[model samples]
Target chain A: MDLHAMDRYIKSLIKEAGHKIRNSFLSDISIESKSDANDLVTNIDKEIEQFFISRINRDFPGHRIFGEEGFGDRIEDQNGVIWLLDPIDGTMNFVHQKRNFAISLGIYEDGVGKLGYIYDVVNDDLYHGVQGGGAYYNDERLRPLGITTIEESILAMNATWAVPNRHFDHNGTLKLIQDVRGIRSYGSAALELAYLASGRIDAYISMRLSPWDIAGGMVIAREVGAIATNFRGEPGNLLEQDTFLVANPSIHSRILKDYIRQK
Target chain B: MDLHAMDRYIKSLIKEAGHKIRNSFLSDISIESKSDANDLVTNIDKEIEQFFISRINRDFPGHRIFGEEGFGDRIEDQNGVIWLLDPIDGTMNFVHQKRNFAISLGIYEDGVGKLGYIYDVVNDDLYHGVQGGGAYYNDERLRPLGITTIEESILAMNATWAVPNRHFDHNGTLKLIQDVRGIRSYGSAALELAYLASGRIDAYISMRLSPWDIAGGMVIAREVGAIATNFRGEPGNLLEQDTFLVANPSIHSRILKDYIRQK
Candidate 1:
């Protein structure tokens, strides 16, 4: 398979989908909650997912697509030539703020990530990576991650993790919050990972996230030498929702061992 | 005093300052530490503060200026006409991320805020307000804030507040984090208040902020019917650094009374 041609084709398709999503902001947004009030799904989210599925099926008939919004084909495993898509990551931000949202896509061949793309719709920033070819933030090749300790690092962890909850032990998470230089939460897992890859922030932690939410980011982040793993310091499960910790390699092990207590 | 004229003048000055700051990113940044390694001050910050002080002094004589970089006039009191300037509110973000920073300025006459402006440099979003006249994001007038309960609101509080700290009691802050719908930390107090005024977020709480950081945001936020006060529920002091909480009126008192315990 021609990896260069596939990468070029995927980038164009993501941009096209992003433009359509941007145009939708001009009109009224039909919003509905899913699972909970905070979990929002808009009409545009479904439409964008459908758009990607149609394009992929028409252009590459042999590939399988797994997407959020339930508009694409369903698969139990990360099989050959699988396309994982999140039409709108940070849907709540999109529904309310009209910014800070992105279109995330990851293309894996034989269960190995070959290419990834995350497009910040409002900022027009496109962060992409071709495995072993290095990551690029809109044509500027991102440098590999540098070593940084937790005390000097700025982390992106949601504050909810610091409070007692069913997901994990809150005591360890609270201690981690005090140990880091600072904290940030953009409400988008994909964008947080993009930031980690770019070295804008040193680490990111989330208790629960699905494959579509992190697939694209995982690919881009790995190219820049950032580490991604579940709470147990094991490899991330690509086919299911799980706790995640992605960070600069130097501090990743320390955090997992000292500040993470599984509930 | 002609607030209308001053508002117009300050708007143009902020836009000019913002444009200059955006240009500075094209050149190399000379950075230095202030109180600690994390507290960064850049050459551009001093230059921009000097630029504002010069313009204000030249255009509006007899006015005093209090700025973050010490290039402005020495201000001891909130007496007489005064301009509180933070050339770059989030200097760390300015030197590191090149975004999420703002040009914050508030003009007060004899201790009363007459006009305020917070310009988001990268996004080109200018949040300004004329006391009694109204608040605005660019030319659009902002509507008065509606009521929101703590459970349904999104609060922008830094995660540091939730950990055991010297400033405030962590247990209460941790509970607040759990009760709220979500929390966000943008790393810029000026932009956080701007977001609160725009209704993008519901509340903002900062344990330690200087007069320059909160002055512009206080004026803009108050115009949109949000309450601005110290953590103790008293009005924010314009002469010194203090803890601050700005929010939609409904939840402001509840958060202040129940959650914030100054240690």
Candidate 2:
């Protein structure tokens, strides 16, 4: 398979999708709640998703697509050359703030991630990685992550994690918040993971995240020596939404074993 | 007092300071811990503070300055015209991430805020407000904050607030976390308040923040019809560090009454 040619094609597609999404911001958008009021989905999201699906189908005839807006194929397995896409992650931020959202895509072959791209549409930051080749933030190649202990690290976690919730025990997460040097929550998982890869943040933990939310990030993060796992310290499920914790290599085990308790 | 001329002068001075601060990012920065390992102060921070102090002292003599770096006046009371300055509000972010910090300054007359500015240096966003004049995000005037219920509001708060801490009861903060639509922590109090003023986030809560940290934000927030108060619903202290809660007027009392309990 010509990986370099495919990567270049995907990057151009992502940039085009990003431009379309940004252009939509200039017009009025209709927003609706999915499961709950806080769970928002905008028309622009669907438009962008369909844009990617159309391009992928037209360009790559045999390739499969799994997209957040359900505009792609329904494949239960992560088969050959499957593309995972979240056209606009952080829809709430997009609808409300018109910022902090990204166009995220991950390409996999036989369930193995081959290439990934995440574009912060507003900030104009594009983070992409190839399997053997290194990751790049914009045009600069990202260096491997250095080791950082829990006490010296800053964590990116939602404030709701420490409160009473159905997902995990609050006590352990509470203790984790105290031990870390600082905590940040940018409301966008894709950007948060990109921040992890860029060393802007050391770790990120979220209770429930979909495949597209972390697909591109996981590939880029792995290139920078960061580890992505569920709270149980296992590899993330590529087919469904699940709990996620991505951290620097040195502190990943310590955080999962000591601070995360699955209820 | 020529308030308009002073406002214009301070605005220019802040932009100049922002340029200097941004330029320093290309060079090596010397960092030192303040109260603890996580509490950092950089040479650039001190230099920037001195820069503001010198500009204020030279440009507007007899105007008292209450600055974070101790290069300003040590006045016992907030009498006459006083400028409250936090040269670099998010010093940790500046030292580590090279972004997300702001230059915060609030000008007051006999303890009453007359003008305020929060310069997001990296983003080039300047949020400013004048007494009896409307607030602005860059050149555009900010709209007055509309009512938002707690269920629909996003709270900007530190994750540590929900865990056991020295200031407030964690249990109540935990419940508050669950009650809001979402939560965000930007690591810069001034920018957090600017976010509130710009309608990006609905509220901001911090356990202990100095006068300079929230001084500029308080003025801007008030101009947009938001309310700034302590956990007990009193006005925030202008002379010292104190607990702070600045929120949309609709939900400020509800959060203070239902979620915050001082221990």
Candidate 3:
């Protein structure tokens, strides 16, 4: 598929969705819990997800979707064109802080990511990428990520990695926590991945994330020469949830082999 | 002695210092490690700290300075005029992100906080508080913090608390992390406190902080009726380093007794 036209259409749709969200932010909107009280979803989240899914269904029929709100189709495999959508990536941040949330979307073709977008709705910034056509923020073409050691790199990860946990070897991740220059957790996975592309954060690692949580970010991170892979160094699971580590080219191998990869 | 005059002078100093930083950013500025490579202090941080201390000493001759750099006086007591300053509150963020750091300053007279200031140098927004006059963000008077529960509250804390650690009961903190409406870690203690005062975040916790780290923020947090106390629910250490917990009034006692209070 020719990406130029697709990219333009996606961008317009994203901006439209963002405008809708910005307007609702000032009005009366109800918020509800998803799986738990800590997991939040606003009326806008449902509306936006439905809006995107409906648009895709109208524009490109039979294209599958894997969305946070269950508005998308039942995606079985990464067989064909699948659009992964996280209408509001950081719902808790959106519902509570009223800032720091974003709309995340990614397009994959034949089991491979082709394009991605992460829009910071409040700030009106857009990060987008085509598989081979380097990432761009607004109109500026992003340069490849710079190389740095973990000690010199500012990681966009929570301090929780420094503690013991059931998922990863807590002790090893903790060592990485102390070995790095600093750690940060911005509460938005999409924004964090976008930052990785922008070189604001050298690397981002999370123990577990769903497909919608990272689809858009994975494409953008790759455009700037960053690598996105699961803990086992396999290509990330687009059909299922798994651990993720996105980092600069130089540090990805080191982080996976030295710290995050199991002993 | 008048807080209004002191606040005006401090604000001006902060603006001028910010101007100097803005002018010098990425222009022959030197940066080096303070403790580790990740902990950076640019020539700007040192220069800014020195500049603030010199101005304070000249304007208020007998005032004691407690600042990030060693230029501040060795403050041994809370008596008399004590100025706490963090030249660059999020030094790493300033060095890396160039957008999130701020200049944080707080003043206490005779063990009573009389004034506080947090300047987002890059954005040119200032949060100041004069005792009994109410907290102000930029120029708007801040409303009193609302009473809220841990389950319903948003917490601004590093992600490490969600995982197990030795400093405090990590498991207990993790429970609080899961119980709260949301969790955030912005990497700047001062701005986090300002947000707490303005009710953006209901609570903030950290394992260790210096007198200069939170001195000004403690005052601002207090004015909004938020509880600014150490983890033990004792008075925050005025002379030495200690764990800090500042939260909304309704949740402070519960957090202390439930999560932090040692058996």
List DockQ for all candidates. Answer: 0.73, 0.88, 0.45
The DockQ of predicted model 2 stands at 0.88
lDDT of 2 by residue, A1-263 (tens): 69889987888888888889888877899999989989999889999889888888999999999999898988699778889999998888887678998988898899888898889999899999888788899979999999789998989999888877776788999899889889999999999999999999999999999999999998999999999998877898889989999999999999999989887
i-RMSD of model 2 (Å, 1 decimal): 0.7
Runs of candidate 3 exceeding 4 Å displacement: A159-166, A261-263, B159-171, B261-263
Q: What are the root-mean-square deviations of the candidates from the true structure over C-alphas?
A: 2.0, 1.3, 2.5
lDDT of 2 by residue, B1-263 (tens): 78789888988999999999989978999989888889999999999999988888898898999999888999689889999999999998987688999999999899899999999999999999998898999979999998789998889999988868666678888888888888889999999999999999999999999999998989999999999998778898889888899999999988888888888
List of clashing residue pairs for candidate 1: none
lDDT against the true structure, per candidate, is 0.89, 0.90, 0.85
Query: For candidate 3 chain B, which ten residues in a row score worst on lDDT?
Result: B159-168
What is candidate 1's fraction of native contacts? Answer: 0.73
Task: List per-model TM-scores for chain B.
Answer: 0.98, 0.98, 0.95
- Per candidate, the number of residue pairs that clash is 0, 0, 5
Q: At residue A130, what lDDT does model 1 achieve?
A: 88
Better of 2 and 3 by lDDT: 2
> Model 3 Cα RMSD, Å?
2.5
